[model samples]
Target: MKRDINIFEFPLNLGLKKKEHEIEPGVRKLPDGFRKFDFHKEINPQNIFRLDAPDYSMEIDQESGVLNAEGIIEYAKEQADFISENHKEDAFNIILGGDCSILIGTALALKKLGNFGLFYLDGHTDFIPAHLSETAAAAGMDLAIITGTGHEKLTDIQGLKPYFLEENIYCAGNAETDDDEYVQQIIHSDIHYFDLYELRKNGFGKTAGDFLKMVYSKALDGFFIHLDVDVLSDELMPAVDSRMDDGIDYTNLREILKPLVHSPLCFGIEITVLNPDDDKAGSYTQPFVKNLIQIIKNKED
Candidate 1:
């Protein structure tokens, strides 16, 4: 059956510390970036819906470099619940996020719906604790929080511990870096961690095929897809708070995502951490939006 695709936006920069190349995380300008694309005119209004999201900027913790994780959790939870309550079971969702921490609420909403898994694609493991957060971006800790590994406030959201089991999660394209110790944590944990290098070695198409099988086998209520823009190569997407020298390319991302999103078990998707400052003249936003449009359209067909 063809499903409705609704869009929601969370424009803020709750993550980021010092800038590189003065590359600030101006997530607040994300909606504006898309506006340049005139998304409303491009897609059919009958199939696309919009949400009246918060219209203000949130202050980041000067020392922590991330907005208060707990505080954002409370707010994001409400947004997720609202979508769950208002949308149909088959409605395909595309959430535009300020940062990856948005997953805490998304996972919680899935918890309320029933058993669900997570498909995480990013540049870093995001397993750092409060003390080990080198830049203090809560986005960096979202994965650990979703797995019920960190802070009680996040781990215990809606009284759901380990919201997504390690077996139910398939994290692809997480490139290694020397700046964080999260790599060691993933090596020791039960999470299905596939580095960008390994994915390329095994081939993204082959690995994505195998990964989807794993997710379907473990999922009772399907799964959610989280795409952190930083997963793409620095040369292609340098708009993130953290950049990796090597990573997945845009063409490779589409190949990996197309089949998985076409699966019946794929419930929704959230794309986060795209800094507009780096995307001058809608160069990146235009193509990104085009890909998403095709992805959503393919889901209905």
Candidate 2:
């Protein structure tokens, strides 16, 4: 079936205040020397799809560890409805996120349609419960909340059990500064962990090929690919809340994702953590967006 694609942008910064950054309107404008890096200039009319998340007010309470859970649920419901309506027409949902927490809503939406596998690409595990989180950031608990392991309001947003089984989850290129307990949790969880050192030694092409094969074998249906900018090397992608120096490099990322982008089982892709504050006058973000668009367009062609 021919695929219809929708690109949705969630721009709120509710999850980042704890990290000391501020949010602003509009795409971060490129500085004088960075003007040549605009990614929108390369858009292909035929294969591209776009949408924007509703502008809901957001607040973060560090003392109480309470996020606007109700608002998040409402936003998630809207996203779920959009996906359900579009799925009937054979369309794919490509979400650009405000923060990693957006995954909770996206995953909830996907779960409503039946079973789907998650390809979570990030530097951190994102499995910490709200109470235990050092930073108490909502983004930290995104994956756990969707899997029904956190607060009731966050976990029960979709009126279902955990979105997917732990066995069905896959994390690629993780190189976080997690504590020992977090490390043990990753080692113990059913989620397969492919460390950065392994990818470097085995080469991204080989590593990604093996991972995709494993996913396809286990996934009876299709899967969604979620990309967090923090997964990229800090040198190349400085526009994220979590900047790890030893993460995947741009070249390796392209190699790792190309096969999956073209895979029949790959339903959609979500790109997150495009924090304009950390970016150098949009210097870092434009090229990354260009590469992502190119990857998707090449697959379409």
Candidate 3:
């Protein structure tokens, strides 16, 4: 049951607003950044594909109430097509992302394929609607959009509303708990929510095991793991756009990802939001690439 890995590089940064000092969100450099550490060479992916992204912009679409709505939608369509054309049923796909917004394209591709579940692992809930988001960055509200909570233009792309059904999602590793409004969105929804505190209490390995049970029980086409590097502790991974105070460590990451990555039903996983600009020195990226390679290869060996 050794699945060959196929890597897709989607260097899109249209989800976030550029800071005054920066030209664009540094997340766009994520794919190349990983390459600097020879992540692809070490993993030895069967095929590698790269999708060029649009230039950075901060235009807020008045209709959709999100930044770069038109650009995001356009890219998502292209992304879906690219994925559908190259996606192999047997090989595991690893999508390297520019930001959390990359999920839209991945989600669209999955929806077109069949009934799929989502394992959303992020430090922030990313469940806020357009009005609630001060920045109106799609990256901040991607989960909500994918789950059919935002404007119809973004959520109902190609008539696929709610790319992933709420019941089939397991959103874990949220550390931003103080904002009741932010935390309550997912809590109220059908998504199985697990904040940082609850995750540790239930145990990381056990939580992953529990999620696997649901995947199996549903008899889904497959599940995709969404790994936002920001889910790592601030001390260990501070190169992300938004930094949380405390998060799970490397061991916890491995424990949670092992079973999910090894499961035969897994379609693939996506890595997002590890900004190279913030990690000018390869210190953080080095360990991240090393740990991730071990996790992915651990199942094969």
Candidate 4:
């Protein structure tokens, strides 16, 4: 029997540590934006599941990095439980997130089953510490928090510190790492990493081969993938929350992604930060979706 792909939609802007006024708009439209295109035919996923958080009452206390919401943690717990008990056991999960912060909830779900690694493919390191950031965007600090390296409260989500073991994580395809602090944090930490230049220098196949080798050698139960579309350079596909120049282009992206998407070791895949507002002409949608389906077919064959 053919295997299955289960897609999850998380539609909310609540996860930010950044004040709403400062955040770039149109992220909340991601889920809605996705609906404009026909993924049902394109990717042909088995089922699409959506996880919705309760209406936001969250406020950020910038000094300490707390979200300042009473119910948000509980909401995350519920989302985690839903993924673990219902969807995870049955299908290959594809999560469409409002922002990278969705990792906080989904990673917890992956953790519940067994220890899992992360394949973070994005433009920014998103390794900034919450306390150090006044923008307060949880999206920026997701990788840090996921690895249990950020503010105490976020690191300890559900009492699961170091939600993902550093040795098991591979942060591939990060661009624009010039920020001294973000670079410093990643350097001091144990997460396996490859910058855009490093990945391209070796080519996508070798990078994927080396990355998977490193991941499988550790012998973790499974791993989840996080794809921030901003990792693509503006020339090919520019519809993103943030753009990174001189990043991977479409051809190399497919080459880099195919093996991993096809890898048996991959448990779940999440796509985030595709801002529909940026792509009003729908010029980039279908081909991008098609490439994703082809990525999966690499595994199927």
| Top lDDT model | 3
**Alpha-carbon lDDT of model 1:** 0.71
Q: What ranges in model 1 sit over 4 Å off? A: 18-24, 45-67, 299-301
Q: Which stretches of model 4 miss by more than 4 angstroms?
A: 16-24, 54-58, 66-72, 88-90, 299-301
Q: Could you tell me which residue pairs clash in candidate 2?
A: 7-51
Question: Candidate 2 lDDT, tens digit per residue, 171-205?
Answer: 77778644777766667778777777755787778
Instruction: Using lDDT, rank the candidates from best to worst.
Output: 3, 4, 1, 2
Candidate 4 residue 224 C-alpha distance from true site, Å = 0.9
The per-candidate count of clashes, in order, stands at 0, 1, 0, 5
Q: Which stretches of candidate 2 lie over 4 Å from their true place?
A: 18-41, 45-66, 87-89, 299-301
> Model 2, poorest ten-residue lDDT window?
25-34
Which of candidates 1 and 4 is the stronger one according to TM-score? 4
lDDT score, candidate 2: 0.66
TM-score of each predicted structure versus truth: 0.87, 0.83, 0.98, 0.89
lDDT of 4 by residue, 1-301 (tens): 1458777787655655333554434565676666667665556777777777555545775544656423445656777887876684546777887777788888888877788878888887887776666566677778887787666666787688878888887787788777777678887888777888887887878877777887778787877889988888877668776676767777787787777777777787888877666777778765666666667656331
Better of 3 and 4 by TM-score: 3
For candidate 2, report its TM-score. Answer: 0.83
Whole-model lDDT, model 4: 0.72
Q: What does candidate 2 score in Cα RMSD to the true structure?
A: 4.1
